[model samples]
Target chain A: DVKVTQSSRYLVKRTGEKVFLECVQDMDHENMFWYRQDPGLGLRLIYFSYDVKMKEKGDIPEGYSVSREKKERFSLILESASTNQTSMYLCASSLKGYEQYFGPGTRLTVT
Target chain B: DQQVKQNSPSLSVQEGRISILNCDYTNSMFDYFLWYKKYPAEGPTFLISISSIKDKNEDGRFTVFLNKSAKHLSLHIVPSQPGDSAVYFCAASDRSGGGADGLTFGKGTHLIIQP
Candidate 1:
């Protein structure tokens, strides 16, 4: 079975702070994705990486960036956290043409 | 532009009954459809998927039916148990949509099973 793990299950940060959310997948899949879920908006893709050091913007990718230093790890970074950034963040990985496996998700509260 | 849409935000059904969740997509180019189930505090899990080549796909008690002309799909859960209660999301991807493109998701439908 594939396992996707996130660094923090819950986090709280004050406004203007920088935050980093980490995700690791055991399967070594080539594709990794970051998404944010908000009420009435479902899961909106923030960023996705198809290879190490390569990233692409999704539908919503403002105030957020990503890094893939290693194939198994993907990180999401918020340059300056704001109250509106509070939401549930999800990480997913998949091989091409396959369904994605998701991590437990990280709930970040920017106060 | 919210290409994918799940009109019903919430649905309530009695346990052991059939729960039908509907989804609609505005883009006809989408060829692959997928359903994901999300529990409280957990990320969405892939439930079942159907390609454009087929109209119906079944797995255990869950089945997905796709209508090409209408640009719609439905997930039917028979004899739904309490564990089946969760949020269901409808997603779609076109043939050209590469892995990096990811899947477009709907707003999601919350299913509640009452015993």
Candidate 2:
């Protein structure tokens, strides 16, 4: 079985603070994705990396960025956290043509 | 524009009955479809998938049906259990390759099993 682990299961931060969410996968999949899930809107892609040091902006990537310094690790960074940024964030990894395995998710609250 | 759409926001069914969740997509290029189940405070988990070439794919009590002409697909859960209550998301993918492009997801449908 594939396992994806997120650094934090829950987090709280004040407005204007910078936040980092980490995710690691044991499968060594080539594709890693970051998504923010909100009520009524569902899962919206934030960013994705196909390989180390390569990233692409998803549908919603305004205040978020990503880093893939290693094959098994991917990080999501918020330059300036805002109250509206509070939501459930999910990390997923997949090999080409295969189903994606997701982490437990990080629920971030910005106050 | 929303490429994939789940018209129904929620559905309720009694235990031991069949629960049907529907999904539609505007992108004709989508050749693969998937269903994911998500519980509160948890990430979505892959359930079942169907390729465009096949009309139906079944696994255990869960089944997925696809209609290429209508660009629609559905998931049917037989003998719905209370534990099956969760948010179901439908996703579509145009191609499957080792790249950053992931599947496009719908708004999701919350299935409530009435026991």
Per-residue lDDT of model 2, residues A8-101, tens digit only: 9999999999999999999979999999999999999999888999999998999999999999999999999999999999999998766788
Q: Report clashes for each candidate as comma-separated counts.
A: 0, 0
What's the TM-score of each model vs. the native?
0.97, 0.97
Score candidate 2 by TM-score against the native. 0.97
Candidate 1 — which residues are off by over 4 angstroms?
B97-99
Residue A31 local lDDT, model 2: 91
lDDT of each: 0.94, 0.93
Candidate 2 chain B: worst-modelled 10 consecutive residues by lDDT? B94-103
Tens-place lDDT digits, model 2, residues B1-115: 9999999999999999999999999998888899999999889999999989999999999999998988889999998999999999999886744375588999999999998
lDDT tens digits, residues A1-111, model 1?
999999999999999999999999999799999999999999999999999999999988999999999999999999999999999999999887668889999999999
User: What tens-digit string does per-residue lDDT give for candidate 1 at B1-115?
Assistant: 8899999999999999999999999998888899999998998999999999999999999999999989999999998999999999999977576655488899999999999
* Runs with alpha carbons beyond 4 Å of true place in candidate 2: B96-98
Local error of candidate 2 at residue A101 (angstroms): 1.0
